[model samples]
Target: MQIISALSEVSDRYPALFVDLWGCVHDGLKPLPGAVEALQAYRAGGGVVILVTNSPRPRAGVAAQIEDIGVPDDAYDNIATSGDSARVAMFDGAVGNKVWHLGPDHDAGFFDPPAILSNPTPIERVPLDQAEGIVCTGPFDPLADPSDLRPQFLAAKTRGLKLLCANPDIVVDRGERREWCAGALAKLYTEMGGESLYFGKPHPPIYDLARRRLAAIKEVSDAGILAIGDGPVTDASGAMGENLDLLFISGGLGAVETGTAPGGDPDPTKLNAYLAQTGVSPTYVIGTLR
Candidate 1:
C-alpha cells in the first residue's frame, strides 16, 4: 500500500480524486506550487477531481476563500465542506436553540446565526456558558489555541451542553505554521465527558454525500476514485472506513511530528507508523502534489 511514484504517475492511474483542500492543496495562505499544475494536468488527462474539506464554512464560502488565497476554482470538479452537511440539521433546528460561537465568523455564518459573536478572540467567557452548546471552528491563535481550553470545556460539560465540531481536522497549515483545529479541542472535550457531534470525513455521511455528487460521471465508482489528504484519522482513516483508495502526504500534518524537516516530505517509516495506528495504509505516498 505504501508505494512511491512521481505525482504524475499517480494522477495517470486515478482519473477522479477527492482532494483535501487546506493541507493538501494550500496552506490557508497560498496554494502549494505545482498543485494547480498537477490538477490542471489531471483535468487535461480527462479526469475529474473534487476537493473535499472539513472546513466549517459553506462550500461557496470555502471556495471563495481558497480562490482568494490563489487556488483556482479549476483545481477541482466540485467542493464539499462539513458545513454543507451540518447545516441540514442546523436549519431543521436539531440543536434547536442558538449556538454559542467559539471559532471564526465564516464558521458561525455556516449556521447563518441571526446573531454572532463579533469578537473573534479572547474566547468570551460569560456568554459562552450561556449558549446551548459550543461549535468550535478553530483556535483563534495556536499558541493559545482551544487546546489550552481543556479545563474550560469541562466546565461547559458540567452545564450539560453539546459541542458540535464543525471542522474535524486536528491541525492545519496557516502558511508555514501548523495550528490546532476544532477536532483536537473536540477530542479533549470528549475525554472530559462533554458530548460532541462531528460532520466531516473519515465519517460516513460526508463521504456518502461526496460520492453521490459524483454520480454524473459514468465511469467514476468503486476503485476508480481516490481520496487524498494529510491526516491519519480524518483523511486516511475516513477513506479507509469507506473502502476507498487514498494518498497520504508527509508534507502536511505529519511533517514535524514524524521528525521530517520543514518544507520537506515525510519518510516512509513514520508514514507506515501512522498507517499502522490508523489501520489504513494509502495506495500512494506523495510528499506533495508537485
Candidate 2:
C-alpha cells in the first residue's frame, strides 16, 4: 500500500466517496483530529461524499450522535447505516417484526421511533423465546467480552430464531479500549447453528443502498468511486465485495500490529504484512484520514 499524507493526492480521481464512520472519522465520541477537515476539503473539491457506517441505529440517529459529538454538518452529503438497511429489509418482509432486541436500551431509537410512527413493519421487542426473530444492535454491555453473550446466543439458537445483525463490526475502538459489537455476538450465534443476517459494511445490501444514492446524484460507475475506511475486515472486505478502490486508514486496528514511527507514520514492513495476511490489499494507505 502506498502511504499518502493527504487525501487531496487522489480525491480528485473519484467523483464519489464512501467513507467509514467510527474509526475513520471519529472514535465514537469525538471526531478524529483533522478527519472532519479532510472530508470538508474533499467536498470542497467537488467530490460527492456519503458516510457509510456500521452503526446499529438508523441514519437519523447516527447523524444526531455525530453532530452531538462535534462532527461538522458539511463533512458529507448523505449518511447510510446498518440500521437503515435493516429497516428496509424488515419493511420488505424479509425479516419478521416480532424481534427480541439483543442490545442495550440506549439503542431504543433503532426500534422505538418506527414503532411510534407506525411503519409498515414496526418492530416490537419481545422476550427471547417469544421472538420470531432477533435484532442485535450491539452488546448489552460494550465493555463486556463476546463470551458473556454465549448463553444468550445458545438460548436463541436452540429456539431456532434468526438474528439480524445491525452492525457487522466485530469491535470498535472507544479511545483506549476495544468494545465488542453486534457482529461478534452474531458470529457466536452462527457458530451455534443459528442463521444470521448482517446489514453493515462488508455486506451487499448497505453497499447497494449507498451506490443507489450515489447514482442518484451523478452518473453511476463503480470505477469512479473510492471507499475510505480503517477496518480490514469491514472496509477492505466491503470494497472488495463491490470491486471499488479502497483507501485504508492505517491508524486503527492496523496500527496495533503495524507500529508507528515517532512521526506516527506506519511501519512499511509491518503494514504490508498485515494487509497481506488479511488478503485484502488497499489502493492506498494513510496514517489517518487527513
Candidate 3:
C-alpha cells in the first residue's frame, strides 16, 4: 500500500467518495481534526461525497447526530446507513413479524419504517421468548463483554430465530473508550449456531444501498469512486469486495499496531506488518483523513 500524507494527492482521481464516518470523519464524540475540511474541499471541487456508514441509525438520524457532533452539512452531499438497509430487510420479513430488539433505548429508531417501502410488513417488538426473530442494533451495554449474551443467544439458537444485525461493526472508539457494536453480538450468535444476517460494511446490502443513494446524485461507476475508512475488516474488506479503491486511515483503530501518533504519519514498517496481519491491501494509507 502507498502511504500518502493527505487526501488531496488522490482526490482528483475519483468523481465520488464513499466515506466511513466513525473513524475517518469523527471519533464518535466529535469530528476528527482536518476531516471536515478535507471533505468540504473535495466537494468544493465538484466531487460527490456519500457518507456510507455502518451506523445503526437511519440517514436522518446520522445526519442529526453528526451535526450535533460538529460535522457540518456542507462536508458531504448525502448519506446511506446500515440501519436503513437492515430496516428495509427487517420490514421485508428478513426477520419474522415479531422480533426481540437487543439494543439500548437510543437505537429504538431501528423500528421506524423507511419511506421508500410503500407497503412494509407490520413488525412488532415482543419479548425474546415470544419473538420469531431477533433485531440486534447493539448490546444493551456497550462496555460489557459479548460472552455475556451467550445464554440469550443459545435460547434464540434453540428457537431457530434469525438475527438481523443493523450495524456490522465489531467495535468503535468513542474518544478513548472502545465499545462493542451489533456485529459482535451477531458474531457471538452465529458462533452459537444461530443465523445472523448482516446489512453493513463488508456485506453487500449496505453497498447496494450506498450505490442507489449515489445514483440519485451522480452516475459514477465503481472505478470513479474512492472508499475511505479506518476499519480494516469493515471498510477495507467492503471496498475490496465492491472493487473500489480504498484510502485506509491507520491512525484510528490501528494506530497502536501501525505506531501512528495523533496528527502524524504511520510508521511504514509497522503499517505494512499490520496490513499483512489483517490481510487487507489498501490502495492508499493515511494517518488520518487529512
Best by lDDT: 3
lDDT per residue, candidate 1, 88-187, as tens digits? 5455454436567667554556756322234222232236657766766766665466657866787789988787777788877788777788888888
Scored against the true structure, residue 190 in model 2 reaches a CA lDDT of 88
lDDT of 3 by residue, 1-290 (tens): 78899899999999999999998899989999999999999999999999999999999999999999999999999999999999999999998999999999999888989998999999999999999999999999999999998988899999899999999999999999999999999999998889999999999998998999899998999999999999988999999999999999999899999999999999999999999999889999999998
Model 1 CA deviation exceeding 4 Å by range: 113-126, 145-147, 150-152, 216-219, 257-266
The best-first sequence of candidates by TM-score reads 3, 2, 1
lDDT of 2 by residue, 1-290 (tens): 57888899988889989999988889877898889999999989888999999998887888899999989889998888888887767665555778888898988877644442345665677988788888888898988888777887888888888888889999898877889999998998888899999888999989988987787778758999999988888999999888999999888767777775322778888888888888878999888888
RMSD of each: 5.0, 2.1, 0.6
- In candidate 2, which residue ranges exceed 4 Å CA deviation? 112-119, 261-263
User: Candidate 3 local accuracy as lDDT?
Assistant: 0.95
User: Any runs in candidate 3 off by more than 4 Å, and if so which?
Assistant: none
List the global CA lDDT of all models: 0.74, 0.85, 0.95
Worst 10 residues of 2 by lDDT: 112-121
Q: Sort every candidate by lDDT, greatest first.
A: 3, 2, 1
